[model samples]
Target: MSLPSYQKAAVIEGTELVIKKNAFIPSFEKNEVLVKVIAASVNPTDWKHIDYGSGKTQGSVSGCDYAGIIVSMGEEVEAKGDLNLGDHVYGVVHGSSLERRNNGAFAEFVAASPLVLIKAAKPLKTIAKGQENIPSGPVETFEGASTLGVALTTIAITFSYYFKFDFSKKPLEDDFLLIWGGSSSVGQIALQFAKIYGIKVIVVASAKNHHHLKSLGADHLVDYHDADAVEQIKALGKNHIKFGFDTISLPQTNQKVHSAVSENATTNSLLPFNPKDLEDYRSDVDITVTLAYLAWGKNTKVPFPWMETDENGAAVSNPGFPEACKTFFKVASKALNEGSVKHIPITVLPKGLNSLNEAFDLLRHDKISSGKLTVRIEDSA
Candidate 1:
């Protein structure tokens, strides 16, 4: 296929998103695949990069969470599995990393590690008795699958990677988990994964979302707006909740989560918090932060399912992250097909990539609630 030398992408211009028509389409590395982005979802991370200008340099493309078709692959991808050119996939990339100038997903094409891309699976809907059935195409629309990568990957690391929870076993009847801000994209999916992994969960969110979250498998609900939100959770679980995840990661919510879990429990927060900011919590309670891009950069020490230690007992480089991401993506894709994982509601913007600035502004000003903001990119194919 003859590809374009220049592609359209959204880049940060001071505090706004500038759609550049002549952005370069990133080339793939040895272990990477180049995707023709069909749908791209905007996350809070995108706006944070725009507003704070952290980890960004001149000409860095904006946005992440993409669903697309594999237009090309490096030499190594064929040996990995069924992945190939023209397969539809969705996953996360370090879209705004300054380390790679052409890193972001907002562009018409993106080069992502094969480890981060999950081959999209469509579910079977036909019911024929006493006969074999075959499903066709992706069960999720491009926009629906677009919502999975960042939210699912981060929460997976929080529980499966950081907390070291075993996903192979079913949740014990007595086991309880507590999550704050349960209606957020990460929170909602986290609730689904925890439930499917065999743990009962208590969640704190707005009362209006209570019924919706409960349907997603949250066992107990506490309204965050209620004055006794912590007390309500603590009273119901009574030190039974051992694992805590704070998706909101606000100072007040952190303290409340501290009071809601068991004495020796560990908690994971989406955003990092300084130790001083959490002094009110008991010293015995361990709090760790989960960053979705930990495996993307070269210099990170985040643990993956496949990392190994050197002879000196120091953790070696992230050779296994690609495999780890590939493994988790398969698990998540299965969950999605079987209805164990549900896609969050999304609000799609018009005008393709040009609508990113307005979409990001919705997140920046808190105009969005519960649903994710997505932009359907015009397929250059």
Candidate 2:
């Protein structure tokens, strides 16, 4: 297929990406594959950066997490000689970030790391007893492959390092996990991984989202809207929370985490504060809480500081730090193809670069909830 010089694109005129008539299609690096994007998904990062400017500016179009076809390959790709034109592919990365960093993908063509692209390669086997391997095979769809890229990895990292699970052995069936904001994409991935490790999970979401969370393998679903979330959680179990993961910010997300955790408390955990009335003592209950985003500066407030603990027994201040989840991302990709996990549901938009900016508008306003918001940048066929 011959390349086109100018194409329909989502262009950032300033803070807003205005759909423009003339734009550039992406090209692949020698180590990359050129994808004719068919489906694209948006993460919180999508709008968080766009509207908030918390993220760097996008030079061209912005959307990440895509599923498409390998229409063209670079020299290294051809030399390796496995993937060819028309193969289904999917992976996650902010197309916006790609553009800013050097190779942008929010257009007709996106060049990607062929070897590292998530879901491009199919799963071969469940290996390391704890991890899954991606070998060669009939690849999974972009929607499915795209499910895991970041969402699953976030969950896996929490399990492997934050929760301190022994991958050497199948996770103990008796273990328990609690996930706040269970309906969001990240929370949904946690639900799937909890099931994968044989960990029973309790999710906190609205009544409307309860059934949906159950489908994602939530053993217990708590209603955040209810007046008695804490009491209800206690009624479910006196004290059996082995792990806790919150996807929302507290105060605003409002202590659903604190209330649920005060009831269940990770692994019979204990907290340390000055002895109340000089009559308090410490115990070895062994529980920890992990929130995913780091407190880069003092600006980020942590909820549970009194909990006597560390991240995997190491001294650490922040809970939701990045950089830890890369391994989990790989695990999630494997789980996706192995059929162990599913991407949070998505509203797939019509295929075309023309619709990019409008789709981004929906994402930027928090207008979308429950599932992922996605658009197809190019026709796969």
Candidate 3:
């Protein structure tokens, strides 16, 4: 396979990424790989940074969640398991960040850490109790594979730390979870995790999406637009709901969630809103925020025992963040293979990269609901 000297890329200029015919593919370090992107999905985090005009240097590509074939690999990757040259992989990226500003999923090619890439369309061998290998299932499509990265990463981090569950054990049959904004991509993904772990789910979304949410294992659904939505949730989950997740953590939503959960129940929010403000409303509830990108940040250590390079590719001593991220990907892959996890329906915008501006408008104004919006960079093989 021949590689291009320069590739077409969507370059961020101020608040938008302008499609450029010829742009340099960003370089990777010792632990990275160069991928030919087949598909990419637009995430709220990508647009949030663009809306505020931060998280990038000039001329960066602006998208995340990509699926592609590995055309090449880094020196260290040869020692890694499963990944190989020519393998099709799908995972997340932090595009438009200061570290990866010049490179992103919204391009013909991308440089990525192997830590973020998962073997696409394969049966994942899951390790159960005592590390026994079990065939979970197989991932079916690139689009579905691309959707797993951000939502799963964030939710898995939340489950690992905030919920403190042991993945090796079977899920508790009596546990119940409440997912606010359940039709959103993150909410839908989290529903799968909860269901697989044997927890009953209570979801809040539009009434129209109720059937689809149920198919994804929602035990109960409450229309967010209902005047008594919070009351409905409380009625369904009374005395049993042990956890609450707020995908839409607005002030009002948080207040409503506080009203719905049991006293002393733990709630995880994807947003960075402070729990202090909620203290007056529900002082007994435990609240915490989760960030998916924490493992990729520079000089940070939580999931790992050591340090690594920051997103800038500068060498740092960190060893464990990449490994921790890899472990989460494996867990997510197993969930995906088990055939219970699915991507939110995707609305494919026209004109490829040129359609991003219009798509972003749809996202900004909340025209998109119950599904994700994606651009097909390359057709399905």
Candidate 4:
């Protein structure tokens, strides 16, 4: 297959993302693979990078989750024998990142590291026009596949590495996991993974989303808007909630989630928070944050101040995270192939890269809920 020298992409211009019709097609490094991006999904972090972080510069491409075909591979990737050209794959990338400026998923082609990529068990099914909100189950559509990369990586690391769960053994029946923002993309997937491991789940979400979350295996649902939301979680879990994940991670949400957990329980957040802020709430509880970009095993620069950085302001590398992610990806692949895992439903935005502006507006204003915003690259043309 012939590769193009230039392609259309969503590029950062000032504080907003703009469609560039002639952005350079990035070259792959020795440890990377060049992919022809078929579909990409919008993540909160994609907009946050531009709004809250200084990492993205003008002309940097914008996005993270993508499902596509491998068009070319580096020598190291080829020698590994784990992936190949024409293989359908989905994975996360640090879009609009300071480290990899032009290699974002919202483009015609992307240069991605093979370590963070997952080979799909089957080819991605094309979604028909006006049927974007397909029923959620397994990995099938490119739109659905695009939503899995970021959520899966975060769940894999949160469970296997941070929580230190032994996948060989099922969790005890008494064990409970609390998930804040249960209607969000990450929260929904976390609910499923926790159930698959035999752990009961308590979800905090809107009242309208309870039925959907219940279907996804949430044992208990607490409406976050309720005045007694935290107390509800505490009562439902019988104050024995041993694990908690705050997908929303606002300071208020963190406090509520922390307050709901039992003493000595472990809680993880999507964004970094100062321990002092939560010290008044619960000192006995352990609090940590997960950055999925660390699974790439590279130094990163995140917007939050809680992230550790060197004199150059780059985050330190976690040498062990990449291998841990590799192991967990195998586990995830098995679960996906067995149809035990479900991808989040998505709303396909028209005009591909051109639709990103609207997508960002919807996400920024919190107009979207319970589903991801996706774009088919072919629609750009």
Best by lDDT: 4
Stretches of candidate 3 exceeding 4 Å from the true structure: 54-58, 122-139, 297-324, 379-381
Please provide, for model 4 over 1-381, each residue's C-alpha lDDT reduced to its tens digit, 9 standing for 90 to 100: 998788888999888888888889988888889999999999998888888776445567889999999999999989988888999988888888776677899998988877767788888887998775766778887788888888888987788878876677888778899999999999998888788788889999998999999999988899999998887888899868999999999999988888889878999998988877874567778887888988877777765454777777777668667866877788778887778888877788878888898898899999988999999999986
TM-score of 4: 0.96
Please list the C-alpha lDDT of all candidates, in the order they appear: 0.73, 0.56, 0.71, 0.85
- Give the per-residue lDDT digits (tens) of candidate 3, residues 2-62: 7778878887787787888778877777688888887677788777767665433456687
**Candidates sorted on TM-score, descending:** 4, 1, 3, 2
Q: Quickly count the clashes in candidate 2.
A: 6
Indicate which candidate wins on TM-score: 4
| lDDT (tens digit, per residue) of candidate 1 on 88-107 | 88888777666566767788
Tens-digit lDDT track of model 2 for 1-381: 877776665655567666655666665578778876665666665555566543345454665566767878889888987677777766544445422432344555567664335544552211122222222122254544544444544454457656765444576565567777888777877777777767777788888888878877889889888888767875674466656666754443424444454333443111222322222222333334443322111122222243334544322444333334444555655766566666666555554455555666776676766776555554321
Q: In model 3, where is the ten-residue run with the lowest total lDDT?
A: 126-135
Decide which is better by lDDT, 1 or 2: 1
* Model 2 lDDT on a 0 to 1 scale: 0.56
Model 2: runs farther than 4 Å from truth? 1-7, 20-22, 25-32, 54-58, 71-86, 98-105, 114-116, 120-148, 164-168, 234-237, 262-330, 356-358, 364-366, 379-381
Which residue pairs clash in candidate 4?
none
Task: Find the 10 residues in a row with the least total lDDT in model 4.
Answer: 51-60
List candidate 1 segments past 4 Å from native: 123-139, 300-327, 379-381
Alpha-carbon TM-score of each model against the true structure: 0.87, 0.68, 0.85, 0.96
Candidate 2, run of 10 with poorest lDDT: 293-302
Model 1's TM-score against the true structure: 0.87
Superposition TM-score, candidate 2 onto the true structure:
0.68
